[model samples]
Every structure is written in structure tokens, then in C-alpha cells.
Target: MSAELDPRLLTRAREVVSSITGFRDDAIANEAMERVVRGELARGRSSADLLGEMLFPQSTLSGTLVRAALVGETYFFRQPEHFRYLSQVGVPAALRRGSLALRGWSAGCATGEEAYSLAAALQASVPHGFPVEVLGTDLHEASLETARRASYGTWSRRESAPRLFPLYLDGVDRQVTILPVVRRITSFAQSNLLAPLPERFGRFDFIFCRNVLTYFSLSAREAAIALLARALNPGGLLFLGAVEADRVPAGMVREGTPELQTFRLLGPGESASPTPVPRFVERAAPPAPLIRRPMATPVPVRAQVTPPPPPARLHLEALERIEGGDVDGASAVLESLVRQAPDYLPGLLELALLRERSGAREAAVPLMRALRMRAERLPPDQLVDGPEALPARFYQASADAYLNLGALE
Candidate 1:
């Protein structure tokens, strides 16, 4: 591969790849296009033939370029909070609302892990024999095939991943297959966010499109969100990546006070209204009969008291700054958050990582030690009091690396 390109070709390459896969990384897009161009040239295809494909990026040849550029890196139970919320609140709430069957979609699902994880969680939460279906979609055919195989290596099982339910059958040679029960409820297919999801795939009770939209162009991202929102059942939940969390689609209400970055699609007659009343009345009530109705008691309107910002919100703000490449701003926010809530584990851990990243190893040591001490006092499985509610062992394991490295120094 030449790895060299004309400026015009590079610009056109980015547009074509972005149109096909919605990838925002120019370097990856350019590199992949160069490699594909070389292959096409070697295959005796003329430059004009390649230009035609660029004009129609949805063609099979263009899909090859997209597959080349995409990085399919995902693991089972990648973010546990979404799964935790599903089991604790989402599932129960759906049952309470009289949902007979549960359906879920994992948009941008790289492989079967997330889809299978969701299936396992739903199976555990719902009653026996209750219907459950989970669809995992990715643009890559190889990834979709791997998902269909339902087996993963040790790398897919990170320490941070929690076992919210039975996820695997058994391990052999460091690879495990997802349990048959879970696999039975889960399916994988190749699909693009830029296109409409098939109508045969009905509205879902919840959808996990986490960490996927970050690759899209701005307009495409908004369009994709609309599709995801539209795919949801009224009052359905949408889980997004932390970086993509703030971009709540229209007709959706962000849920929870923490930085879980989940949203709820408004059901029929549901309003993302400013008035936080118990329930919305359909229409104007008929005036009470003038003679017989007793005098109504006066209802007092209370002042809307704003609560102080939680450590989680501050932490999320800091994370957003970090993602925006504003390291100094993120550090300042984390510092202020720590002063306000010194016991906040996630903040302390994040600050320590930032410090370590900035080559201030000594500054990071105490933060690591403090977090480790707090984690040790709790049972290993006990969830720390924080935004994601990750277990104590997770913090301990995270802190151990820094603490051990410091000791080595």
C-alpha cells in the first residue's frame, strides 16, 4: 500500500467512508481507503471504476473499505450500570406496567456479547417461560458472524465486567460460549445506523446503543438517535455511552440523577414537560356543577428548590471535559469535586488516573491509597457509593496497579 494520496482523493475518501460508516476519524478513514485503493488497482480496476463506488458508498466495494477501517472492540458486560439498571429498575418497572414479553436491541453491537448479556439479564429478571428477544446489530459481517458463534476469549471478560446474571456456559482453552438459554433469546445481524431498522423488528422495551454514536458525523448522529428513539416502545429506555449521554434525542426524557446516561422515550400522551406533576390529565375537566360541589381547598404552589449538584454530576462534567481534550479543566473540576465529597470513589480514581497520565505519579499515589483503603473496608462484592455503583473489588483492583507501581518506584 502506497499510504500516500492526493489531497482531493483524501477529501473525497473521507466523505465516502463517512457516508458509508459514519466514521469521524480521518486518519483511519484515509488509511483504510488507501489500502483498498491499492487492492482495487492491483485487481485491474481503473481509477474511474473506484470513483463510481465513491459516488455510491453503499456499494459492496465501499463496504469493504468500511470493514477495513472499523475497530470492532467490545466485551461482554462492558458497562455494568446499564445492566444493573435493567435488572433493578427497568425490568421490574416493565413488569409492573404489565409487559408480558420483553424485547431489547443492541444497536452498534460489535459482536454478540452485549446482545447475549442483555438476553441473560432479561432471562434472569423475567418469569420462567416469559418471552425475551435481543437483537445485536453491527455493520461488520465478520463481527456479526462472531456474535452468532457466541464464544469469546479471556480478553472479552475484563475485570471491570460484572456478572449481573449467568452469561456463559463454561470455559475451555480460555474461551467460553454464552449459555444456550441466553443465546437462544439473542440474535445478531449486519445493519447500518444510517438506514432504517426493519419494521419486522418491533419497538423495544429498552435499547443499548452505548459508545456507538461517537463515530457518527453530527447530522448522522442526530439522525441515528432519532431512529433509535423511534424504534423504542413508548416509554422505552435508551442507554448511551458517557460521551454521547448528554445528547438526548427529541421526545425523550433523561432518567436518573446519576451519570448513567439513560433516557426514556415519552409514551403516548407523555410529555417531557417542565411541570413535575404526578400524572398528566388528558384534557380540560368539565366545570363542577355550580350548586352541589363543595368549595375546593386552596392548593399552594411550592417554590422549585434546586438541589446542590451531586458528586456524580460533577464527575460526569469532568469526564466530558476530559473527553473534549480539556485536561486542565477536567482536573480542576475533579479537584473541586473531591474537596466537596472526598469520599467519592469514582472521582478519586479518575483524578488519580489523570494525575498519573500527566506524569505526576507522586500526586496520584495518595489518591490511590485513599481509594484502596475505602474499598478494603467493604466486602469485595459490595457496590461502592458512587455514580455507576461499581463493586469494591473493582476499585481495589484498579487502585492496586498504581499502588503497586508506586511501591516498585
Candidate 2:
């Protein structure tokens, strides 16, 4: 299969992919082209015809090439912190301005997990009777079809909190279907991030383009960000994946802790703008307090006491148990460590991995869910007095676990 195609033909295919999808990775573009070539040859079609089809606008082959070049890795509540910020920060600000109507856009919303997740978060956080609308846009029509179906296997729900399942899904046999309430507020459409947004797709108060920008070329990423910026209302919040923190555009101001990867569009007078003024004239108010829950009763001061051994020690002990083939013991140690320090990212991750390896993936679900919840409340700079204490590193570790376990792509 590899011997038949000319080198120049493959190079032409690669160039066409970059020009169409704006994917900059040479290796990925090459791989996708090779696969397309092989598949076309297998079907007794000429490489020239395949390339011509792919170059055609919105061709099925073109969509296939783009989908191959990009990953649609997503799950319900994959990044809980962003939803937390939306609920605890973005929503209340809008409500306070006497606007009960809220609009949100989930750009690159793979199969609608993110769009449904956002709707669920709003339903759970906001008071009843508050109106909300969510639009999910992606480049692939097949993904949109699945999004419209709203049924998922258990793997898609791996990162979903147990409490959220009952609130948003109905399970029958192996399939979990999204409830009407969540589905009613959300819609999906096919859209390319590099292209201009549809005029009917109005500006939104919140735009979520998490984990999608890193796949594009630098110029393409800038164009996508600019398009997202144009879609945002004045002072609207734009949430990117933590990995995309470095790629934020010029007209936006980073908001929340640095780890959060949330940005706010600066108002017209607040900053220089190369783009036109936002469509919505209403500006966001000063940020409301992040901690919305009431504080517990204050306790009297007590004498200083010795602190327990650091989480690192327990983590090592757990590792020793795994080495000794005592998986139960290791699990017990990790469970205790996480209980002692609920925000101990490493402990939570190790425990979840252990459960997954032991053929008890369900047992790991709650732990992973808990870790995601705690991760939301933690500051990005927050560190534990133990191994792998860097919050960003911990997040990377968590992401790795999710990918390895098939919770993410």
C-alpha cells in the first residue's frame, strides 16, 4: 500500500489537509493522508480521485480527513472546574444584572457531552424558572448525529459524577440516555472553528472551547480565538483547556486563578480592540464572590499540634503494597490518605488507577469524580507537602489516567 503512492502525491495530500483543516502537525497530516490513500486504494479508487474529493468543499472525504487529524476526546464533566466557575461565577453575575435568560456556546463540542454538561450545571446551580440555552458546534456531522441521539455507553459516563447521572440521564440496559430537560435546552450544529460563525448563531454570555485549539496551526488558532472573541458578549467568559492557557488572545484578560484558564473579554473602553464591538451592549458586573456557600460556625482557637505524616509517605506505603501483590491493602491506604486530605491529587489518582487495574472500574468512578470536584475548588498554585505536589503536574497526571482508562480519547 505504501509503495504504490508517489511521494509527491502524498505531499500534495498533506498540503491540501493543512489548507483545509489548518492542522499544522506534519506527522498527523501524513498519517491521515496515508490512511485515506490506503482506504481509497482498497476500494479500487485512484489516489488522484481521492485527493480531488478531499479538496472539494465540505466533501465527505474532507470531513473524514479532518476528523482523523483531530481528536474528539470528551466526556461529561471532563473538566469540572470550568463548570464550577460558570455556575459559581458566570451565572450569578448575569442573574444579578436582572437577566434570567442565559446563553452559552460549547465550541468543538465533540458528541455533546460538554453541551449537556453545561446544561446540567446550569439546571443544578441556578434557581428554577431561570431560562437557559446552550448551543454545541463541531466540524463533524457524524458527531452531531450522535449528539442529537444523546445516548452513550458507560465509558462516556466514567468522569460523570454519580449524582449527575440521575439528574441528567436515564439508563436502560447498557445505554444511558440524556433526559429531556437537558436535551431541551441544548442544540448541536456542524461548524468549523476556522470559518466564520453563522449569523443566526447569536453572541453568547459564555463560550467554552476547551481542549480544541491545540490541534490547529498557530495562524488557525489565532483565527479561531478571534472568531470566538467576536461571538462573545461584552465581558463574556471564555473557557479554554488548561493546556491552552498560553494561547489566549490580546483583547482578553485572564480571570480567576492562573490554573483555571478562564478569560474575560475586555470592554470597548477597557482595552484596545482590533475586532468590532461586541453585539450585546450589557457589560458584566464586578465578579461575585467565588465561595457562594455560607461558612460554617467559627471554632475557638486551639493550641498548635503536630501534623500527621505527609501524604507522600502514605503514597509510598501504598506503592509497596502494590509491589507485594496486596492490592486491597494498597487501596485501603490510598482511601485513608484521600479521606485525610480530600484534595490530595496524587492519592486520589493512584487510588483510582489501582481500582481500574483490579477490574473494579466502577469503584474508581466515584474517586475520580471526587478528585475532579476537589480539583475545581483548589487554586492552580496550591501544592501538597508530598510527591507530585505541583497542581499543574497533578492535573496532567489526572488527564493521563483518564486517557489510559478510556474515559477520554
Candidate 3:
């Protein structure tokens, strides 16, 4: 757009755009880059001058365009329904029959928001915690660094609804930080959804390759879909962004409202060949109950409390603390136990239940609901009623939260 525009810079812009998105329109690419730099710098004359120097002065922009393009906006709970379906339907169906270890991949996971979001959703659904894991991969190493830092602006907070707002801690600068509970279950790495997935990456129970496929050409899209399909463990579910769904296989079923298409991988001894879409079969007999009564509350330790009980006998003390309204102290013990012994499903359930009792109901609800759903999804050979049950309080509070949001349907 300038009389003295550097042809070299224009070429660099086109190359950057094409490499990042596989789009080859040189003129459109330069126009977009100019617009991005100009828009970001337009706040003041000084900022405008700074951007002009950064973009126009140099023949090659220093990773600036890629950073700008990938510093996308996202929030803690950006897509509520997708998560709900994950909790109550998708995950459970996947894990129903066995003591299956589940893995989830968030391809093109920009800045870690989506991966952390999946971690939160997974924990909510698999209370008393099943064997589950999450992996977040983005092509940009720098973007992965920002995600590793795990901080975001008020702009990111826009994705959370008021009902769930209290669940996140807002920083002094109005940035939001994901709670420690959500961070424990996920890890991030640099990955490109195209090309061979890294040797270390393996089949997963769920894959979320969202909002990215639209950028690829038809051939690239199909190859990526095939690659993703191969990456899924049979019976795994794949979730796509709303716009990217059509690029996935035509035989896959697309469900849920405002759908980001969700597909299920065929189990072993099965094939990916299209099957007549199955009807919603009524569930078999209900599984056994999780708990018979309110669990014992945890207690606090005091120097004066005398002869600290043996670790095994410490349960009563911890129980007493919860009974005496020291839910936070009780939670501390359960959390420590879960960390020391990740296989301790009971500890996870107790912590989840105590969280609900402590009025963190919105956070607790997903744990119980997700647990039930995942338990149901286990393969028939490995099936068992999950080791934990939700306290009535959790469901009641969740029901209220849903009603408040008019999400009761």
C-alpha cells in the first residue's frame, strides 16, 4: 500500500503466511500482515512508529507475524457444551469396559488454554480419578512458552460465563490464572498436526484438533484427518472445531448442538468402515452406589494435639476436621495423599466430595458427573462401578448452577 514498499518484505510476508497456514496468496498475505501490524500499533503515534519499524524497516520480520497470528484469544471454559458432552457422554463412552488408561491430545493447542481446559473437564468426569492423561501440542515453540507460563489477560476472561466466574482467580492486572487443580493433569509440547506425529506421541482416547483444519488445502486436510484417525486408540473420540468438521471423514457421526463434530474410533477387531449410525440404546441396569453415607471429615494437626495419630489412623482426625468445618485442611490431606499415590481413587473422590461440601459446588459437580460418565464408558471386560460416588450435595448444587444458566435442558 506504500509507494516505497520493500519488495523483499512483501516476499517475506508471503512466505511467512504460506508456511504457517499453507495459503499461497502473496498479495492477500502482505495485505493481512500490514493490516495486523498497523492495527496492533495504531493505539498511539509512538506505538504506530514502533510497529512500522518492526514490520517495514526490516526486510524480514523477526517471528513477529507468527507470534501475532498465534497469540489467539481463549478462556478457561470457552466452550461449555463441548466440555459437558465430554464429561457426561464422550469420555464415559470411551472408557466403559476396562481399567483403561486414557490419553487426550489437543493438537494446535495455542497457548495451552485448550489443553488445560481439557484437563479440568477430564478431572471433573473421572472422579476417584481413573487412569487418564492429556497432551497439548502446538507447532510454535514460543507459543508453548507462553502457555507454560499459564497467565492470561482480562480479554481471556471473556470466555467464562458469570456462573463459573467465581471458580477462577483473577490477578491484580485482571489476568486469570488456572487453579492448581487443573494444571496437574496436563503437559504441553511443540508439535505440528501435519507430518508424522512425534515418535513419543501415541494413540489417545480423545483428540481435539479444533479451529485449525480450515487453513489447509483439501489434500492436506484429508491426510491430516487420516493421520489423526490413526492416532486415536480404537474407541477413542475425536472433537473438531465447528468449521473444521467437514474436513473429517463423512462417515463419522456429528452430534450435539452448535456441533463441533465428534467421532468415535472403532475398537480392536473392528474397522473404520462406516456403520449405520447406531440408535441411542437405553442403558443397562444401573451400577452400584458410590457411597453409603457422608464420608468422615478430615482434621487439622496441632503441636498440642498430642501423639499425632499413625498415618493409617489419621483418617478420623481428618474426618473430624471436615465435620468441624475445616474443609480446607481436610482437602489438604486428601490432595497430598492423591499426589503420593495417584492410584488412590478414594482420596480423589473424597476430595471432590469435600469440595462440593465446602461450597465449591460448581467445580465439584463436573468431577462427580464426569466420573459417572467415564465409568459407564469402560469396555465390558474392564467394567466396574467406579470406586467413588457423588454426594447428593454435588448434583444438587450443579442442578442449581445449570438452572441459573438456563442450561437445564
Candidate 4:
């Protein structure tokens, strides 16, 4: 139809479409906006009504445009290799190092597909007895709600490894529900990376901040990365999107075989606890206590919390497996850690690297992406360089790996 809409209205519509979708093309954005406007008109809504319904939540006329802008498209296991790496290398290393009590943050988790995938993988990989805690955060309340519910459709499963499906999800009526086993180990919460983290959540060993960084401007990306660096522990690993990984600041190790790029968290002198403090209490005002105890009731006090015993020996065993070339056996241990504590980024990074080496690239990408997304909000000082850079021999090996993957193209 001939143009009849107000010039300002058309401009607002185009801007909303572009901002939401991260599409810079004016023509395509305009077309998308036109379609939306036409659909609203067909539903017998006035221009103002369409604008109100679609855009007007954040502010009045101007704010509504921003509200209407949202880009949401995702699926479970969208990137497979990243998960493989987590299962094989990252998880095992974290477990061996006795970082079972891990804090995992899924930054901009979207609809929670990746977070759920992590939970499922850990559940399938862990040995008979261990506990794991996982938490996912998203800025969009709607996305957080979807993640909390943990429900998906057939499309979410389209790219999932068929063999692992039964181990993770309950597929019914074309809808896949996260199994109870997965849910028991994972939880979802809402958060914004731009602000200070919620008091309830602290430093995390593993952080998944994938794909989301590409959507932000460079300044925001840098700020987010700095925050993520701070959020991680020394030697804690970071995963990133394939495209985003190279963009990460120097100081963090950026090496993985095929599907993943991992940034290593340097340790204190190569031999220190992954989590230096076992029971770190946040700085806050003390809670009010009861002044009088009833005859049957005793005054409440903080429980005595003990740190778990170190797993240095288990870590040695993992190294033995690596030396013996029993990568799968090593992976078994790593998977256990992920199952018991999937938030440990170092373990996830190690596992992702192993998977890439073992030709499981399809399974490593997600872990890398997840880590990348999480690292975006970490503190920048975490990227400080260590004295030892990669050896010359390792660079040669890396070149060969790149050539094998046809990445030179």
C-alpha cells in the first residue's frame, strides 16, 4: 500500500525493529516494522493501539518503542561442541581439583536452553554420589520465566544429540520437559549484567556468557567482560562464542582444540586452592536476633560449616589418565564434577578442550559460548598475564590444529 503512516511513526517503528533484532539494515528493519504494523491494523487496532500493545511498556510514546524491541530466538543445545568440552575436560578438572562446590552463572541465558543442557550433561556424567548446584540468570523476565519452567518444544531438540536426549529430557506431546534429575541440580534467577550482582550470588568458577556479547556495543562489551573477570576465581575458566573468543582481552589463556576457546584463570603460584575461602560471608548488617528463648526453644545461631576435603589426589589421578591416553576415563571424572557441581568453569574449559581434541567438536561449542557470555560481566583484572606464555611447541601444535579444522579459510 502507498505510505500513509506519519513520518515519526515510521521512524519509531524502524528503530524499534533494528534495536531489538540487532539488525543494522534500515530497509529490512523497515520491512519488519511494516509487517508488524499491518498485522496490528488487520486486527482492527489503531496505530496508537498497535504501538501501545507492542511498544508502550517501558515509557509513554517514546518508551513504548523501546519496549516493543526484543530479539528472542534460541533452542536447546544450539551449540553442541561447547557441551562436549564441558562433559569431557572442564567438569573432570574441576572435580579433580575439589571444586565441587561451584557457582555457575549463565549470563543472558535467554530462554534457558543452554543452562538446562549444562544441567542435563552434568547429571548424565557425574558418578553415583555427588551434589551439584547450578543457577541461570537473564535480564528479560519473560526469558527467565521460560527458563524457570524448563519446558521446550520439538525445535529445541532438533539439533540435540539423539543418544543424550533420554538422559536429559522428558519429551511428551512434542514438548520437552527438563527431567527431575536435571532440575534437582539446576535453578534459574533473573539478573542484569550491567549492575552489581545480587548479594545472594558471589564469585563463580564457571561462567557462561555466550552469543549475547555480540549484541552489545563495544563499550558495553568491554565493561561486561571486566565484570565477568572479577566474578571468577583465579584459574577459573571463561568460555565464549567462536567469534567473540578472539575479541577477549589478553592475559587469559585463549586456547582450545576445535570448537572452543577457553580463557584460563591463573592460579596463585600454580599450587593453591581453586576457592581460597571455603565459607566467605558477605559484608552486610547482622540480622536481628531473638532476645528471649522459650523453654522449648534455644537461641538460633549460625551453623558450623566445614570446608570439604581437598581433592588434590583426584586431580593427580586425572593427570594420570591424561598421560595414559584414557581421555574418556578422565572425561568420566570431569562429567561427575559437572554433574555434582556444573558451575566450575575450569572443569568445563578442560572438558571442552578434551572433547575438541577427541573430535567431539559438535559437543564443545555450547560450553565455550556459555563461558564467553559469563566472562563478559567478570572483572577485567582477571585477565592479567602470567610470566609463562604458551611455549613455542604449543604454537606449532595449535597451527596444525587450525589447519586440520580448515579454520585458516
lDDT scores in order: 0.74, 0.70, 0.56, 0.54
Report each candidate's C-alpha RMSD, comma-separated, in the order given: 17.5, 14.3, 18.4, 22.0
> Any idea how many clashes model 1 has?
0
What stretches of model 3 exceed 4 Å from their correct place?
A: 6-12, 24-29, 32-65, 68-71, 159-167, 247-258, 271-409
The runs of at least 3 residues in candidate 4 whose Cα sits more than 4 Å from the true structure, single-residue gaps closed, are 7-57, 60-69, 160-171, 268-409
Q: Please, what are the lDDT tens digits per residue for candidate 1 over residues 90-113?
A: 888788888889999999888777
- Candidate topping lDDT: 1
Q: Give the Å error, residue 376, model 1.
A: 38
Between prediction 1 and prediction 4, the one with superior TM-score is: 1
The C-alpha stretches of model 2 lying farther than 4 A from their native spots are 27-29, 159-167, 271-409
The residue-by-residue lDDT of candidate 4 on 1-409, one tens digit each, is 5657655556667555444433233112243355556655676767776555446434333333332333344556545555665666667767787875655667777788777776766655567566666678765677778777877876566422333433345667878677777777778876666655776677776777776554443445556677777777765667765434333354455434423555656666653223221111111233345366656955457866555323433333544565444666777766665455444444445566666656676666566554444433433113211111212222222222222333423
Winning candidate number (TM-score): 1
Question: Which window of ten consecutive residues has the lowest lDDT sum in model 3?
Answer: 379-388
Off by over 4 Å in 1: 1-6, 25-28, 273-409
What TM-score does each of the candidates earn?
Answer: 0.67, 0.65, 0.55, 0.54
* lDDT of candidate model 1 versus the reference: 0.74
Better of 1 and 4 by lDDT: 1
Ranking by lDDT: 1, 2, 3, 4
Cα lDDT, model 3, residue 252: 45
